[model samples]
Target chain A: MNPATHRHPASYRDPAGFVFEEDGILYRQIHPRYQPSYEQLKQSGLYDRLVSEKLLIPHEEISQPNTADAFRIIRPQRIRPVIPPFCWTYNMLLDAAIATLRIQTIALQHGMILKDAHPSNIQFIGASPILIDTLSFETWIKTKPWIAYRQYCESFLLPLVIGHHGVPDSPKLLRAWPGGIPLETGRTMLPLRSKLSLHWLLHLHLHARQSRQGDTPKSSSTGFSSGQMKNLIHSLKLGTTRCHAGNKHSGWTNYEQQVSARGQYTSHKLAVIQKESAALSGIDTILDLGSNTGNYSNALRNISEKIIQLESDPQTANALYEKNKTAGDQNSLSLCLNVEDLLPAGCDHGLIPSLKSDLVLCLGLLHHLTYRNYIPLPDVLNLLAQLTNKYLWIEYIDPTDPLIREHFNPERVEQRLIDLETFEKQLETLFTTRYHTQLADSSRRLYLCSKK
Target chain B: MIHLLYLDPGNGSYLAQVIIASILGVVFYFRNLLYVVRDFFYRLLGKKDRSADS
Candidate 1:
């Protein structure tokens, strides 16, 4: 490995190639073993067709890496602020699964097979999820059923089934359980009647039973025709589409809808954001931390070229994703996870934590971190300073905000109330206040600050 | 050429897909054939089956 090249930790699972970045440009180095598959993918015209259909990310063959193990190094087009599978809502996950199956079917027609169906392989470039792993395809063998049948089940089918039963955290659950959701785990999660359904009986219930019994009495590889493969994929598609009941969450779903009904209090905040953002030019990226319902995200969309929203609630993120899809917003990236849980202990974060932006938005979130999360006010500002490259639009709600009383810690909440003057003094340590104001008829104060 | 290291396609699951797909393949094969036949008749009768291309 090159000293400057940092291999992505999650990329080690796939043997064909691994993604690494050198000087901030992402590259996928194809191993010598995967060269044949790569050649077949190109010569067979499968790569071209898939790229033309926009199902696969297009890449250019760059100069080979400076390593003996490397056969080819290609630069795949970048997807900003990659959102993981755990953050995806049921609908987004299902859509990704369907897209995977569709790509598999396409690959089959071109005499190749999609060897893996990991949900993380798909990223939302816009409203549609696209396959980012170019080396996921391999030449089809005569009777090789699917090298990744179990992976498809554990990663997509079972997760969707669990989500269909009104479990919103199924994707997160699957991610937590390691390689994929265990068959028995998925089997137990489904209701008894699932065994009656043909799709479930084959893919989940009996599949679980088959997995536990070790070697099936049948031969390891049996006669599986191409038609049978398509039929199996079709069945998986049927299972995915059967999941339609949307999951709803308690927090902030109706926040955007009520923005107009809240009258002066909300309008004043929006007016302030509009006036400030409208004056800015050539703003490259805007990061909205703690984006609940994209209420403020929608306000800042026109001024910035790209918007990255870090939303905690899956359902809220899912709702925002669906709204973006409906409106056809191509440059929006919504990541769903806890605001403070980005880099958990003993987990993957060597790359994810590097996300920052030119202008960072921290609207209406100070009290939640201070009063509710018990995070020191200075620490929050320090973190915000790290994320913000040039400008920051943050909010500090006064002690009288009625909403602050919901924290339930009467003593703790009162002690942590960061008043207007105190907030300015602390913020001055990191950012110079270019502008500041108290919203009319509301206990909220807004600040537009730039780094000193 | 197969790599020295490749993803472990669980033996049980690989065998199960063949075993189960063999049976369900017959079911869905005929099911797809029946749809084809139905679509053929619909086309002859000048009424387009909405699922003809599905």
Candidate 2:
């Protein structure tokens, strides 16, 4: 509703095109520099084919007759709910990676390639991954090796191998190196035995060596002919097919094997909230923030009509989606999303975004915001309060909690920590704290609040 | 294992299994309660989570 508060970085990648929102509808404005590529994308019929097939988001070309600065602008068909990679379950991420590859192969056929390869560029729409960046296409370079290879590896390959293969902390690997993980860094993380295999050897080992060769004929004369292009597509299709839901690690199956509530702490905390939530009548939907596998969603099954669990971990979200989808619980939907960049759908403009939920749960999620630049905790509470018209069930992890400290680095107990009073002051202004309970040790607290 | 491995090669084969499983996972993601019950038993019996292994 507030313009200053709503503006998102128009996907900060290229220095050229910029994304802007007008009346809640998102439109991308391309400068004169990218005119050639934009022309090629439309004239080549790639735009029509992709949009019709639903591989790419559909956009409308806007031309105003009276304006002097007639810049080429496109308004893409917006997604109802925009989710981030962190919120995806493992399978969802895999699907996204596959979709990106498929899009890349299709672009190559049209003499174009994706200039950037950030996972955030892709999002899930109804169990299928959709490439959201309509501007990623550019005229292909026949002589050069795929320039976006390293990024693909980092944004797509690294997370997949690390999450499904043995590395449980693969997601952290990307978090540490926002720019695609360096090849050498990836090589170091992989076990010595993996280097002997061809896929790892050529892609990871030799690829890193080639990168260091700096300007050593980065482009080869080799180009994919019509037949060879088909083969490449087939190869990518095969690669995506191999990457599937069951490809989880032992740790993933028993994710809490290393971490539990250290006694009956989790159960106690959850039970308290359940008792309070069950008492509320005429409530239909409950949004479970940071729902780590739908455990909390189970608690409100009695009184709540539908429980939507939002998780940041791609793998966890995928697993939760699969679990809930299987039970045919139409009332329950799990989506991967980042709470930091919360946007309300259905703006004043033509942007038909997803409808905002009634209730919101921010359990065990606020601490992660500390890692980024100062996201004033009050601002976050304010945003949550703004989006919801009903009750809010929230949780705060005690500063003394070891897991909280470990997950968040530098252990800035001073700059980041939000005491009970500070947090209460932020929320009490917008809503009154109706019920509060200390879950498990003194680390976890659950509060049920009503709108003022 | 014999039926799957013999039909495909390279990473392509991995995807073939994955696509099959994905379709099945979507179809079965909500319908059959018996699958989860069976999977729970497998998990208890030390059957590794091979859902993504394809």
lDDT (CA) for every model shown? 0.77, 0.61
Please write out the lDDT profile of model 1 over residues A239-303, one tens digit for every residue: 77887635576557877665556558777887888898788766888888888877686778788
Residue A223 lDDT (model 2): 32
Off by over 4 Å in 1: A1-10, A64-68, A216-219, A343-354, A406-412, B1-12, B29-54
Model 1 RMSD in angstroms: 4.0
Q: Which stretches of candidate 2 lie over 4 Å from their true place?
A: A1-16, A65-70, A80-83, A109-111, A141-144, A217-286, A290-308, A311-316, A324-358, A362-390, A394-430, A433-448, B1-54
- Candidate number 1, chain A TM-score: 0.91
> After TM-score superposition, what is the CA distance of residue B46 in candidate 2 from its true location, in Å?
41
lDDT score, candidate 2? 0.61
Candidate that would win on DockQ: 1
In order, what are the TM-scores of chain A for the candidates? 0.91, 0.64
Q: What's each prediction's clash count? A: 0, 32
Tens digit of lDDT per residue, candidate 2, span A1-452?
Answer: 22223334534345446566778797676666787888899999878777776678888877632323224777778764564454456666666777778788778878887776667777655565677777778888653334455566656676666555555335445445545566667767766765554344444555566556533231334332334333334443454455444444333345555547377876676778778777776776677766776777666778876676766555576677777756756566666555654633311112112424567777766776653434777677776676566888888766777776675655465677778777778878888888987775656778888878
